[model samples]
Target: MTRRFLFAPLIAVALFAACRPSPEPGAGGITQVATIDALLAGAYDGTVTLAELRRFGDFGIGTFHALDGEMILLDGVFYKVRGDGSVGEPPQSETTPFASVTHFRADVREELPAGLDLPALEARIDRLLPQANRFCAFRVRGEFRHVRVRSVPAQSKPYRPLVAVTRNQPMFTLQGVRGTLVGFRSPSFVKGVNVPGYHLHFLADDRRSGGHVLEFTAATSTLEADTLHDFLTIRLPAPGAAFEKVDLTPDRSGELEEAEKNPAVRD
Candidate 1:
């Protein structure tokens, strides 16, 4: 009788689960706003607001229109990390030229070992990946032995290519700190469309400082990963002179690498 009673509840639970609606497409996948090519080709015009971006996903990284500042999305809130190493919540009216976000349900959670530099951390994370071509989102939180981050100030009309804008970016390095690293790892096939490898942004525990992560050393960090297999959706800005006139035909991979990896514009 006890066995039959348990079986009855199991059947009822199965029926209830079967009746539940499937998750929507956006809820299950990554929603990318704009293209890396457009941003590279000097399209700093924001077409999506923070409010709209939030609706698609709550956790991700992206920059504001005109490449104003580094953007860090955490716990459903959007923050702007500036060149002066200041972090604040920008007005919701502000928009983003390029951003990638996911609803962030981690499929893998692990506690990584201590004393890993950027390359080592990447190599270790590489082993954890199930495949090379798939897109994945990563979030690591812990004490960083050293972290180099950079942020660019806003530009005016007649925007310059990302490479040029990065030339004047401000770099900051924090040592022996507690913080979180948020970013995405795109496949090599998406190179020109998005960063081919890991593109990460850092936010300190105090929430007072952050920027695009250039390098870092971690100590027993916790890593959470979410695989994005559903789709990558891109939203472009409306037809305008800014985006229409920009020349995107040239290959800017080398230039982008220089800018993103070692843009040391100031002393």
Candidate 2:
């Protein structure tokens, strides 16, 4: 009886193995089934929900303007949307309020008139190339969210906004020095102007060789649009260091002056 039972289990295992299909190979000995989106999504540790994507789309189109809000995630990292209409690094905090707009009407695909083409735009990300030798290459992926336009504000003279990019991810360098956060600003953008081209900001650590935490912050004018039909780029600084936090209250300048006078304060 025991022998018969053992034989029955062995037969079942053999039958299962025989029914399994072999994986097919593709060009260059690499599998071709993985899609660009899948490849992009796989780079992160978490999944990006549809609701979050919609909010991202709203922010991209300038429909969902928030003075202070948390960063949205596509996959696991914080994806920044600047005032000028560009995407930035993933956020470090899930609850931190970063300024953003929520209404965009442009398509973020290649060859789109809005100029936010993902593939083409990604190819233009040159700021980080210099650091490639220092750190391992990681895939940064995202998609555009489609949002309904509610209103459009009157066009103002175009100007550049101060943009800051911060490293929200921690990494250990080959040399073992800790990563430091850096920030920089863009040229400028007009108050109510809409431009055809999109600006972007990339974030990374100082590449010191140790593990370090980085964050991103941008202070720009609130998008003043009633209906949201216009497509605008979420402008961010090009590859640069992170920025220091500034008071967002109406008396921000006064606070800065006070801080400057304090001996403990450092620029």
Worst 10 residues of 2 by lDDT: 25-34
Instruction: After superposing candidate 2 on the true structure, give the runs of residues whose Cα lies further than 4 Å from its correct spot.
Output: 1-93, 107-267
lDDT of 2 by residue, 3-103 (tens): 99989989999898768743321111111111112111111112222233344332321111121111332222344333332334533332221222333
The per-residue C-alpha lDDT of model 2 at residue 53 equals 35
What is the lDDT, from 0 to 100, of the residue 41 in candidate 1? 78
Q: List the residue pairs that clash in candidate 1.
A: none
Tell me the lDDT of model 1 at 257. 87
Candidates in order, TM-scores: namely 0.87, 0.20
Candidate 1 per-residue lDDT, tens place, 98-187, comes to: 898888889999998888777776786789985778888889999998899999998887787888888778988888889999988888
Quote the positional error of residue 259 for candidate 1 in Å. 1.7
What would the C-alpha RMSD of candidate 1 be, to one decimal place? 8.6
